[model samples]
Target: MSLRRLLRTDAAALIAAHRASVALHRSWVTPCLDQAGFEAWFSRTLAEDYLSLIALERGSGAVVGVFNASQISRGNFLSAYLGYYACVPYAGRGLMREALPQAIAYLFGEIGLHRIEANIQPGNAASIALARGAGFRLEGFSPRYLRIDGVWQDHERWALLADEAGF
Candidate 1:
């Protein structure tokens, strides 16, 4: 698989991937399923401290998933919050497990970020495992930390520092 910055031309493929993976991402994330939402999301990525990257299958160039790094703070903070989800055909293949660290390396090495954080819902085992396997430590928990699927959800905070990533 290959990972790269999301492009405007990828709208159709990305929306199709999101539409196909609705069941898999039900309780975890709600990616843009239409052109309007995709446009808004794409707009957000154009902001100063937010970025979105798309992962693709090498041969077919099919979108495997998307990773977003947002709320980046520079200066002494040097950190960002991460969000990601895998598409239907690619969900259980260990592909995200491989690509996440590469994304982190880019954030740390190329973007000069010192920390990256992932907030996961308590009941999502797959997401938790992905975060853990990527070297994120269990930092803490927050009640009603985020609203997902129209309800307030609790979350476990996980983080990885640049030094801890063994760059």
Candidate 2:
């Protein structure tokens, strides 16, 4: 699979992929984020210059996953937060193992970001594993860090620094 920047033309495919991903993680993801919300969110990200990417099957052009990184500034820190999901069909295929490093490299090298973080639901083993595989170190846990599936959930924070990773 290859990763590419999300395009306006990819809206329909992204919606379909989003729905499939939601279904797969319905117990964790809020169902209220419907198609309209997805479109609007994507638009807002585009306007904010966030890097949103889609993983595509190289041969068939099928969208297999979506990933996003948004630059954030707080006090003296300038960093980015990472979010991603792989469609069920693409899970366990090592696609993220390939995509994430590229994304991180781009964030640090091209975007000039110093750090990237992943806030993963505590019980989401797949995501935690993915973050570790991508060389992010688990920092600590946050209680009631986010609302998932309409309920407050705890999250494990993980981070990677560009200098540390030598990227």
Candidate 3:
């Protein structure tokens, strides 16, 4: 798999992927499934504080998943929050497991971030395991942390620092 920054031209494929993965992503994420929504969401990724990337199959060029590093802070706190989801045809194929370390390296080395955090719903074992496998440690928990699918959900905070990443 290969990782690259998200492109505006990816709208059709991304929307199709998200639409197809609706069941797999139910209650986990709500990606834009149309052109207008994609336009609005994609606009934010153009900002300096957000680094949005897409994982692709090296040969077929199919989208495997998307990894976003948002709300990046500089100066004393060079950190960001992570948000991601695997697309249907590619979910559970160990593609993300292979791409995550590359994403971490991009965040720590290319983006020059000191820390990256991924907050996961307690029941989302898959997400939690992904973070853990990528060297993130359980930091703590937050009640009603983020509002998803119109409901506030609890989350476990997992984080990895640049030093811990050996960068």
Clashes of each: 0, 0, 0
Any idea what lDDT model 1 has? 0.92
In candidate 1, list every pair of residues with a backbone clash. none
Q: Write the per-residue lDDT of candidate 2 for residues 1-167, one digit (tens) a residue.
A: 68778776777776766666776767555422456766676675665547787878888888777778866543457588888777767877888777777777777887777888999998788889999987899999999988876788888999999887796
Backbone clashes (count) for model 1:
0
* Best of the candidates, lDDT: 3
The positional error of residue 24 in candidate 3, measured at the CA in angstroms, is: 0.8
Candidate 3 Cα outliers beyond 4 Å, as residue runs? none
In the range 28-70, model 1's lDDT, one tens digit per residue, is 8889999998999999989979999898988899888999999
The TM-score measured for candidate 2 stands at 0.88
Q: C-alpha displacement of 63 in model 1, angstroms?
A: 0.8
Error of 3 at 153 (Å): 0.7
lDDT of each candidate versus the true structure: 0.92, 0.77, 0.93
Which residue pairs clash within candidate 2? Answer: none
